[model samples]
Target: MGELVDRVDEQDRVRGVVDRGEAITHHWLHRVATTVCRDGEGRILVHRRAADMSRFPGQYNFLVGGAAEVGESYEEAAARELTEEIGVRVPVRFAFKFLCRGEISPYWLGVHDAVVRTDITPDPDEIAWHAWVTEDELREMARRPTFVADSLYALDRYLSRGEAARADPLP
Candidate 1:
């Protein structure tokens, strides 16, 4: 299967310049994932990536995520990743999108934050463990453990601007 391709606009769109593979391999690609979780006060959930992951292993991170498959919508991918990673079924809402531009390739990332309440059985291949934290608790923990810098940034942006951050969330 091919990776989903979007047009090259500052915002996501369909353009004629690049093919899906080129954008993903040679260039930075756009992928979407959901941070499906809830808190201890029934507010939010947090998960940690397995320590053995190739990207950011053992990092405090989103509960579920994956690249959008060819012809798949961001919401669909988010929903699917959520189920695959954590065995949860929850409605996903568009929270934010991030661009991970590196010196080489760039990553067009869509981040959705969803609320869910259930026992999370993390896939050993994907995650190590998960927990729920209140907004205050998250703010506190963001200070210590190594987390997805982008996720923390999003949280700060959400708190400060009272609007979702327009900038790409750093990985």
Candidate 2:
């Protein structure tokens, strides 16, 4: 049996449940959660996906997460993914959410950010390599094709929002 995931509509409303592989193959809108981990020095954690993974194999991803299981909330999925992919359990802050239409999978991506003070033990099956990189360094790496598409999109959206927020101060 395959993993069961929640199927969502264009507006992110839960439609029903389906197998993860079927969701990907049919391009069904599904729930996905991603957690971006950062250190005290402001460096972000980036990891290379295992070469055998179905999507974005061997590509660098700044976020660690996966599809939300049936009946799981976005936050729950985010925290669970963080712990499963990297051996770190920390409080994650909700960052943003967006509809991501990728080549292999279309999902409603729930993005979260966390400051990890604990040590990380990446799962060898999910992550090939891991590192801490400055924002500038991440941007440089993202310019290449080695980075995951959805991650780059999410990062760009997050940074743009940060810039806009910094530019417009509340009176």
* Top-TM-score candidate index: 2
Q: What stretches of model 2 exceed 4 Å from their correct place?
A: 163-171
Clashes of each: 10, 0
Error of 1 at 23 (Å): 5.2
Give the runs in model 1 whose Cα sits over 4 Å from its true position.
1-9, 15-27, 100-105, 161-171
Tens digit of per-residue lDDT, candidate 1, span 99-166: 65633356556667666645677788988877777667777877766886656645654446442432
Candidate 1: worst-modelled 10 consecutive residues by lDDT: 162-171
Top-lDDT candidate index: 2
Candidate 1 TM-score to native: 0.73
Name the lDDT of candidate 1.
0.63
lDDT of each: 0.63, 0.86
